[model samples]
Target: MAVEILIVDDDPLIRQTLHQQLVALGYSPHVAEDRRSAEQQLARQEFALVILDLALPDTSGLALLKHWQEAGTSLPTIMISGTATIPDAVEALKLGAADFLVKPVDMFLLEATLKRVLAAQALRSENTRLKQLTRGGRVDFLGDSPCIRELLAQAERVAATEQTVLVEGETGTGKQVLARWIHARSGRADEPLLAVNCAAITETLFESELFGHEKGAFTGAGERKPGKLELVGRGTLFLDEVGELPLLCQAKLLTAVEDRVFERVGGTRQMRFEGRIIAATNRILSQEIGKGGFRRDLYYRLSAFAMRLPALREHADDIPLYIGQALERCRRQYGRTFEPPDDNTLRQLKANSWPGNVRELYHHVERIALLTDGPRIPRSLWLSFPTEPESEPTDIPTGDLRTAMTGFKRKYIQRVLARCGGNQTEAARQLGIERTHLNHLLAEYDGRR
Candidate 1:
């Protein structure tokens, strides 16, 4: 996800130029001409980082930063000044300014500073959340679907023990939610919940990641670093997407799981940890074992206490409940009270299959809330499904399945395309797909013509 940045400056040229630069750097930049507009944006929602000019037409940027600190908004702010002095820089730093940059700032330096500040802020938030997780509080596991409820029950039971657990489910099935729930209920509830996406780490960095590395251990090992397992201490180490872990790393992981000890890359000393292991994956482990992608022994160790989350399709009955929940959440987040769907709209909602699951539902709800003029969302929201001509037959009937299916898909696609002003890119964006994917589907339909 791109970071959201708010740039506060009175100069229109500076704001426009920086906005363009920030957008090109994969950030959503919102410009505020003065302190008032900046405060409004800050009050509305949090930004990943803020770039504040030292002088605004209405107020000094230092006062604005202090105001933010007083108002309890902890957004990291970078102070940019054309007439900066040592005392001014010290004062700004004392007021929680992340970094001070002189005006006519080197673009490279500005980008590097923003990246570092944003990364530090993210790490701080992560660490704080981890500390809170270790305080033995109950995690509010969302969703009341039967599948989720059953998973919760299983989790509650498994969390009372120290055995390694393997959670299996498709992506966006809230695997991390279940992992956090387990941590909250476990005996190690008052310890850190260190989560690592095994798939994201490369084979070469696997040892350094799973175990702490000493200074001079390897190139770029400028300082000693503690791995997730060590940072987790006596808490929980969650290995998300464990199925994608490299084959060579799997052997080392299995040994670490068995002995609770590991050596960092280029380090001879062994470090021991007693943290609980919770691994999650979207792939079927048995199938992967047959394909020689995953180790059977490691799978068995992790699956000592196993739970599988049912896909959204199997739990179609819960769609209405989830839709209602998502709408309410969107209303709270967006600060707009949208009326619940009417009877006909609710019926359409129940009929549709949410392939992207809860995550998709949330996005759709947010989009509808923002796009709809009035409070009530109509059946149009439900009519936004992609043109799946071949798949429409199952919903219709036999006899003239091909004709019926094609007619339905074409009508739906054309309606949405028209609503989006014939712009395929915008239509695809509204439908949550790439324009190329939409073109391919349209071509497929054209072939049937």
Candidate 2:
């Protein structure tokens, strides 16, 4: 189908010129003389792009842009003005205009800008679709364990409503995946679902990142930016590791959650937040609140429907099913068939505690698939289970048990560190150890080396 373009301009000559150019370029062009007519056209038909003139008879074009933006309209727009200024251009872009142009617009340049804006919008739409497909394409909860069944039941019940949810689980326990499952099953599944990790964001930039900032709001604030809250209009915003949000941000976020209204930093205009919030945290928020690190009020507001994800150890019986799913994903990801783990290898995997939960299992399976020479993974390639300090290696002298254990610990830590690209925090999380403890071990190994 030919792309549809909406031209909103007061001057008949400019509108006619744009219409002719668009038609010549094989686009379906619609003209509106004022904001009222443009709005009526918008309501009546869907346009791929809107060419707006800043000076309209009924209202300023910027006012119309703001109206559309606040209404969560995703239509790509290009703003034009005869008496254009830098501030006007900045404001237009801030209001979500795709591009800005001055009047006496060259026909060629106008067509080029329209094409670029529409193409960019198409790319964004495609990217969003791909993300949704990737997230929603995973297998079902692959366990018949009672805990898993109960969790699925609860998720179904929660998916029927728009209530805020707080998902609590240890790291690598598939909390975000569960959130995605709930979102996909919900009525708002057709809308966008964005995830942000609070723990990953720096405290200094948290406010601007979440609530956005106006141009000139700070030294580096070159353009007005919309935050995640604004972009998640009528969708779902998954805040991972919500406990890590700074106290100052927690207060503001609580207000937004309760009142559904917030203003961009350094801007006085209030914006509405029309999204459901699903927050997750590995830490016990109640403990964090008691320690004065998190707010109790915010905790209460977010935990209206709390869901706790069971650790992998809690459902050991489901390991076989999980392994099967992991192997399937690995096969598709690597474009190679992999035979499942042998009986001994499976026993070894099930015997060890999976501190990193399903994530660890998935990575382990991928590693085995990649490293094994043949289709089936053998027990010899498996990582050795950690032994007690006094346990002796078969080939080691009795007095050298501690030395052998130290060597084993160092090698294990190094392997995990390498897997995490030397990120100590991530390595520590995967190893189920404290970051400080990981640091101490690294220091000891370095000193010994």
Candidate 3:
């Protein structure tokens, strides 16, 4: 689909210039001469990008930007003005403009900026779509263990309400998945479910990430941006690793959790967060509060309804079922079939401590599927599966399989490529995969590295 861009400017010359340039660049362009017309266009159509003149005759472009911000519009925008000052540019950005341009907008610079912004928006949209696709088929709770049943019951009880929920579990125990299950059952299931990894984002970026920022809020904040909270709208915002949020952020978040209100980083206009907040943390927050690392009040606010996910060890009986499910998923994912693990293999899997819980088990299953050439996974591969050290049998590896696999694959592929003297074709041949597949893997590896 061609990207559609909305040009909101009173000047006919500027509109014509931008429309021609957008057409040259293979985008569909629509024009609105004033704020009223712009509003009508926005209401009637979905635009991938908006070019607004700050000096609209009917109303200030900044006002329109503010309206979109408050209304939770996700449209990316570029602000243009013939009489724009630094403050005007900054204010426009603070209102969620994607870019700001002075009048006599240099065609080259405008095209470049539009491309950059559009590319970023496309990437974000793709990521969200992939996440939803991966999540779409696997909404059921996998195990029938007692603890699993109780967790589902508790989730059902909470899904009917709008109260805040805190999910606690060991790392890789599927806390986020369970949270999604709750959201899927909630009244807001039809809306977006956005997850933010509080631990992955640094403290300095946390505020802008969660509450959003105005243009000029910081040194590199070129345009106004909506935070995750705003993007979630009336859906669910999953705060994964909520405990890792700094104390300062925690204090600010408390208000949103309690009242669902927050202002952008550089603006005073209070915005309403109509979405549900679901926070998950691997840490025992009570201990963090006692250690002065967390706020007791915030903890209280989040824990109005809490659900604890049991570790895989706590439900050993479910291991076989999980193995079967993992095998089926692998078969579908890789387009290959495999015999289920035999009795002896199941016994070893159950006996071994699954510190990484279900996640670890699934990866092991994938690895087995990748390595096996016959109907059954060789029992010898069992020895290659990672296990906890003898001294720390209960301690599992930290982090998700994606991170682990990325690191492992990057290193392994690099070594192979290096051995092949950086010859991609040779490396692919040795790796027993198509050259295009190798190139894709190499691109992903380099991106992560």
Candidate 4:
């Protein structure tokens, strides 16, 4: 499609000249004579580029730009002036104007500026799309639920700012994923992202880990080593399981994160770092504060932009999609063909109240695939707490453990076929077996649910 250009100028000659130049370049051009006409055109049409004159008889172009910004109009506008001033150009740029062009505008220069601005907009759009699609490029996010969708949108908005995000979630709910997503979309994405698992570090090593240690500072210290704070300069530092931080370390960390400066362990020399701090916890921070487990002041600072990830049980509907993706990942890791759970197995998987959430479900699938024989994994591979009674054993003479195993497998095959809505392909995938082996199993068992 041809690019759409809007020319907003009071002078008919200037407008006509710009229109001709745009048309020569194969652009669809629209002309507006006055402020009212321009406003009307903007309301009715969508333009990729707007050539806006600074001085209008009825209203100033700068004023129009400000109005457009206030009204949430995102069209890229290039400001044109017959008498351009440094202040005017600065002000135009501050008001979200794309470019400032001095009058007697050269056609080539104008086209070049327009192309550059359009390319920038296109890049931004593409980045947004990729961020939205790739699990929001989240560190550990593993679900495709509506709750996660809304959380990603929130993350996008928060990332544009330098707010200290505090992610709160239950244990194993992937708080680190939310923190990484926030850092990934932030302005400091190019900078390093350093993480400190507070729960993993002891109180004795907390200070050294957070603040660099000078030579001979501790028993094992040989050379100077930078801490997480110093190492993450002009980037982001993630503190996971912050509730485990000791009081003294908490105070020091709070000061460093707030002031953007810190002193190394056993050293008095100060160091500065321009970066963002994102903290996460599995416990209720407010309750922790009341219980004297966390610092109130620090909590307020970290909670500037709070986000929570939904538990897997809350978004069980997304399990099938997650299973499919997880299975693909497993297949890649194990060098096996992808086989999704059959409908019956999927139903059973979804019905379970996943107390361990996504992490647990992943391990379960990986383990079951390893234990099951052939390509198809029958429902028997998974531990099912069925309420139905166990059938009495048939006493057949000359029966061995291998025969008993075959008979058990036959019954399990029948049960799975009964649950898979009669789709052989789905049944095979669910059993984690090859389609051919699944067909043989089904033939041996027949359709006896």
Number of the top candidate by lDDT?
3
For candidate 1, the per-residue lDDT at 398 reads: 41
Tens digit of lDDT per residue, candidate 2, span 1-449?
88888999999999899899888988999999998899899989899999999999989989989998899998998999989899999999999999999888888898778767875686577547745753556435567789999999999999899999999998888898888888888877777788888988987788788888887999999756778887676778999999998898899889999999999889999999988999999999988987799999999999999999999988877888888888888788778777776777777677779888888877777777777655666666565433447766575433487888988888889999988989999999999999999999999999998
Candidate order (lDDT)? 3, 2, 1, 4
lDDT of 1 by residue, 92-177 (tens): 99999999998776778987898778766765676667778557556776767777788788888988999899999887777888
How close is each model in CA RMSD to the real structure?
Answer: 18.7, 13.2, 18.7, 21.8
Pairwise TM-score winner, candidates 1 and 2: 2
Instruction: Give one digit per residue, the lDDT tens place, for model 4 in 1-449.
Output: 99888999999999999989999978999999879999898889788879999999889999999999999987899999999799999999999999999988999998789877886676455444433433334454555678988888888899899888888887767777677777777787766677789989988888888887887887999756767776666677889999888888789878987787888887989889677888888888898997798999999888998888777888888888776676777777777755666787778788887777777777777776666542566667664432447787684434798877877787677667778977888878888899999887777667545
Q: Candidate 4's error at 433, in angstroms?
A: 60
* TM-score for each predicted model, relative to the true structure: 0.57, 0.61, 0.62, 0.54
Compute the lDDT of residue 117 as modeled in candidate 3.
92
| Error of model 1, residue 89, in angstroms | 40
Instruction: Evaluate model 3: give its TM-score.
Output: 0.62
Each candidate: what lDDT? 0.83, 0.86, 0.86, 0.80
| Colliding residue pairs in candidate 3 | 93-215, 94-214, 94-215
**114-194 per-residue lDDT for model 3 (tens digits):** 978986787568546634643455478788989999999999999999989999999989998898899888998867788
How many clashing pairs in candidate 3? 3
